[model samples]
Target: MTTQHLEHPTHTHTHGPDCGHQAVSHGDHVDYAHDGHLHREHSGHWDECESGAHTTHDGHTHVHGSDCGHEAVRHGDHVDYVHDGHRHAEHDGHYDDH
Candidate 1:
């Protein structure tokens, strides 16, 4: 997986345990959910958490798409389906955490 390389410009608010935004674990880092998107602290700056490892959601038989009964969020290059308490994105014939 690769990072988007897109920095969130003029980001003044620091996200953390008490930042009010929901914290989601992404691979080896923590990303904060804010403004309908995910943000990660990187190199003293903030970037949209858009890329990561292709972790397959085993036993996930439900296909996510239009009218899939889940909230579809427009991500950088693809759509993520909100299920349970996390987001899932389709990649390489499986769903990965977004």
Candidate 2:
């Protein structure tokens, strides 16, 4: 996976306690889930955070989305869907273990 250095557009508010976004601890920093994406404060701007490595879910057939039957869970920087007894995170064009 490639690391992206894109700044979040239309991000105007500060993220913290009571910021209405889910916060997840990431290494020595924290990331907030915003607008279906993850944002982290860097320098003086908000940067989009993403994972570089993922375990691909091979041979999976069902599709997961906003209206899917599984429950949607807010992970570190993305949403994961609860399926069977585990969580599936969308990565690239496939799903990964959460």
Candidate 3:
């Protein structure tokens, strides 16, 4: 079995007075086959922020506050694995051996 790995770095920023402003960060990893079709895995963690605060991740920010009250903000990551046989060959037309 062959293994391929990749890493991605991320950053986050938050602002607020009652919740306290701060920054958050996390990392991600992926595994796949040489043919770009196989199993995959990933994991990461985000810094903790307070309620009524605005948090920004990877350029997207969530403001935690009601019309004019305090609110809570939550975020997370996702992972997807796919196994395709002819998906790439059909797209690139590079399948020499049929």
> Could you say which candidate leads in lDDT?
1
Q: Which wins on TM-score, candidate 2 or candidate 3?
A: 2
Model 2: per-residue lDDT, tens digit, 16-95? 97998877655556677777777889888898876555657788789999888886757655677767655578878888
lDDT of 1 by residue, 33-77 (tens): 777777899999998887545656778888998989987766656
Q: TM-score for each prediction? A: 0.61, 0.54, 0.18
- Cα error, residue 11 of model 3, in Å, equals 7.0
Clashing pairs in 2: none
Q: Where does model 2 exceed 4 Å of error?
A: 1-3, 53-78, 81-98
Shift of residue 86 alpha carbon in model 3, Å: 6.0
Candidate 3 local lDDT, 1-98, one digit each (tens): 11224332242322233334321221232222212222223345222211122221222122222342322122222111121221011112222110
Error of 3 at 90 (Å): 5.7
| Top candidate (TM-score) | 1
Residue 57, candidate 2: C-alpha displacement in angstroms: 10
Q: After superposition, how far is residue 21 of candidate 3 from its true place, in Å?
A: 29
Model 3 clash count equals 0
Model 1: lDDT equals 0.78
